[model samples]
Target: MKLLAVDDARARILAEIAALPAETVPLARSIGRVLAEDVAAVRDQPPFAASAMDGWAVRSADCPGSLKIVGESAAGHGFEGRVGAGEAVRIFTGAAVPAGCDAIVIQEDATREGETVLVPAIAAGRSVRPAAGDFKAGAVLLTRGTRIDPWRLSLAASAGRAEVSVGGRARVALLSTGEEIVQAPATPGPFQIYDSGSPALAEMVESWGGTAVRARPVRDELDAVIAALRDADAELIVTVGGASVGDHDLVRAAAVVLGLSLRVESVNVRPGKPTFFGVLGDGRRLLGLPGNPASAFVCAEMFLKPILSAYQGAPTAPATMPARLAEALPANGSREHWMRAKLTYADGGVSVRPYRDQDSSLISVFAASDALMRRMPGAQAAEAGTVVEVLPLSRA
Candidate 1:
């Protein structure tokens, strides 16, 4: 297989993958989800003209001068009396802007004297008086395809939407394939390794807003692999390890047997060149990530994240930022390098320094990385102070 550029590979992968359809979720359970339908205001916000302050709600025409204080309107309680010419009604914040009232004279701007208060030009030269539909009774507040964060949920709740229709969570089936792979926290024999990639990848799926339905290890036998994949019953199947040339690499053979059309076989990217993507005959998507933990993680971040985003109708883009190289970098024209690095702010912009060692098999390097410093194929050794594309792993 010929090695493809990173952008070209990514573009092709995204094009082949399909987004998951939308589904309705209760408002209480909608947070951290994505909206599939546009959310408009069901009713007027505040449901009535409301006071902006705790001061008296009086005719703006009479706010500049003192008038008799008739009754107090606190929040839920509204004044029944009409404010005749030269009269004012005291009102609190959020109280309905009463009839015949145009402005609120703040208590700080007025001096109280028994039943009457002295006030000065609170409404002069200002249209401070709020009108009906100040926030619009039925405005289209939130558009469709919105990611439902805490703030978005609050907005929907405030807009009187008790339930929201959101994009269905992507169902994921995670398989760890290898005869030598054992479930983690186990007393593994010297020949066996704990299955760290499955759990790690599962957490990654959950973090990307998908529900991980299966995280079990599958033996190297092709039948066992097929059975595991069949039992998963997920919209997307993520297989870790056993994707390479070894005899135990049954994921590729199984995918081919399952009638998955290969999308991209190889890419010119370090640590993840052998990553594979395909779609099953039944339309379920498949990703063949490298078995090495670091390689698997990098491939997951590069391919799986965008797939999940597209499934949820969320936008996905590589997080690129300008950063100066903190140290000299070696040139590798054979493959595009994805160097694990730490990014720090220096002199006015960010500076990225690659980790001392970046072997695909070393998970510790990946765990310590705060960013991925990308050097394109055929590029020269990056000199200190050279600007390059840095994908931030940690926002801070």
Candidate 2:
């Protein structure tokens, strides 16, 4: 297959994507979750006309003159008596609007003398009558697919929601295959290597609230690989490494042998061009991530992370920010590049310094970096001051 540009490949992959339906969750646990249903206010935000300042509430007409104080109203308390002409009700912040009150005169603008309070004309001039529906009642307050950030949580609490519906977590199976691979703590001779990608990938999935059960590692044998792929109960299977054209590369061949329809053979991107994606004969998803540590992670973010988010009804894409280059980036003319980098803010924008070692196989850069800077293939060089897009590393 011919190489596909990053945008084309992304569009193709995303075309196959759909967010899962929402599920009900307790409000307490719903923070950081996505809303599966549109959230409407059960009632007005304040529910009643309440004071916004720590001042006296009085009938606006009675202000600018001394009025006999009928009673005092504080938050949670209501003044029962109606304020007649030349009469006032002393009220505190958040106090219910008294029966005949139209506005509030702050305490600073009032002089207290016994039961009568004198409110300055200037204070009366600035008083405001909070209108009904200052915040609408029974209106859509949050949209479906909205992620429950702190503000959303507060809004839900204000809207009197004890529980809400959200998208369910995604389920995935993580598999890594190679004959030379051994579990960590196994002393490796020069030829034998540790299988660290599966564990790391599993952790990444779990951080996103997705369950990533580790499939048993199989030797390079095709039968074992196919068997392992079939054993996973997850909605998607993530296979690490063995995606290239080397004679040992069995993932692509096994996928074909299993009758999985290939969606994409490769994407025009550096560190992860040999990526593969398909659907198995049984309709299970198959994703082949490049073996390089960086490439594997980039593929996971580009493909797997979005899938997980959609499953959970994540409201938006992963956070991205404008970052300046700390060092000159050589122009990429062949494939879009995802450079692992550390970010800092100096002037008004972020500055990204690429990791010294950009080798796809190195794991230390993944650990040390906080962000990824994207450079499209055939794009011009990024000067030290050019603003570029940065995808923050997942904290999960």
Candidate 3:
């Protein structure tokens, strides 16, 4: 089989992930969900010209003289009377500016004496928030595919939107194959290992805005693996371990039995070469990950994240930022490398130091790594302080 370049493999996988369907959800529960349509402002922000400071509202021309304080306005309660010439209304922050008031003198800038106050001159619009200032009615506050974070959701709510139409969450099924893969909470027998990858991948999926359901582990038999694959009903089915074509591997054999159309056979990347992706019968996507726990985690960070991020019609382009190397490294060979590394935030971007041991099965190393120091295929070696590229790894 031809070893696919890392970029080529990523492109192949990205090309196949179409956007999921949309749904309407309340604003309270819309965090991390992508918008299916533009969120338009239903009403004007501030709704009325309001005071932005706790002071007296008066016509700009009435400043520098004593003005009678007629009424007081506080948040949620408006002073209904108007501010006539030589008159001022005491107003709090976010309170509506009474009629005929054009400027607000902050409390610190005014000297109050019982029912009258002397204030300094201020510009016409000083400390006053005009109607439709933040966002006008019918304006698009959030565009399509905007991820509804806390701030965005707050903006939407303030714009009079009680609910929004958001893209459906991507449902992912995680399958951990091989008899050696026993799930946690159950002690493994001698020569058996816990199914650590599926749970970790599930948490990663949730963090990336996808829902993951882990199926029970299967023995290293083609028939058993095929049964599990048949039962998976999610949009994407991910199988951990037993993916390589080794004599003991059963994942690829099961996919073959299910007539999965292969888009990628192997990748030219260290620790993740055995990773593959394809479409099974019935249009569900399949991703075959290597057996090593850390290898599977790295591949998930490199591939699964991008796939899920693009499942809402907005394809997230892979990001690589420049970083200074904190430690020296050796030359890279034919396969591209994603060395587990730690990041020290610096002036511009970050400083990265690769872990000493890069073995595929080191889960502890992978856990401690916050960045992946990327090396292009056959790249030359470099010393400390050399600029390099890195991709952030999110285990949470």
Model 1 C-alpha lDDT versus the unseen true structure: 0.79
lDDT (Cα atoms) of all candidates against the true structure: 0.79, 0.78, 0.88
Candidate 1 residue 3 C-alpha distance from true site, Å: 2.3
lDDT string for model 2 (259-347, tens) is 88878889888789998787888877778898777899987887777767767756234467888888887777778888899998777
- Badly placed stretches (over 4 Å) of model 2 are 18-22, 29-36, 60-93, 102-134, 165-168, 179-200, 203-209, 216-221, 247-249, 309-323, 344-351, 393-396
Q: Give candidate 2's total backbone clashes.
A: 1
Off by over 4 Å in 1: 44-49, 58-67, 76-90, 105-114, 118-120, 124-135, 190-194, 313-315, 319-333, 341-356, 361-370, 383-387, 394-396
Span of ten consecutive residues with least summed lDDT in model 1? 124-133
> lDDT per residue, candidate 3, 1-396, as tens digits?
879988889899999999888889899988878889998888899799999899999999987899998999998999998779999999999999999999999999999999999988888999999998998899999999888888999999998889898777888999988878787789999989887788889988887778898888887887888999989979999989888888888887788777899999999999799999999878889999998987898788778888887886676755778899998888999999999999999676689999999999899898899888889999888999999999876545
Candidate 2 global lDDT:
0.78
> What is the TM-score of each predicted model, taking all chains together?
0.81, 0.79, 0.92
Q: Ranking by TM-score, best first?
A: 3, 1, 2
Worst-scoring 10-residue span by lDDT in model 2: 122-131
**Number of the candidate with higher TM-score, 2 or 3:** 3
lDDT of 1 by residue, 1-396 (tens): 866787777788788656677877778888667788889876766676677777776776786787888888777888876677777777787787667777778778778889998877766323233543435667888898777777888889888888988776888898888878888577788899887788878877886778897666788888888777666688889888877767888888888877889887877788887788888888888888888998888778788887887788875767778899888887766788888999988677899999978889888888889898888878887689899988888432
TM-score of 3: 0.92
Native-referenced Cα lDDT, model 3: 0.88
For residue 53, model 1's alpha carbon misses the true position, in angstroms, by 3.9
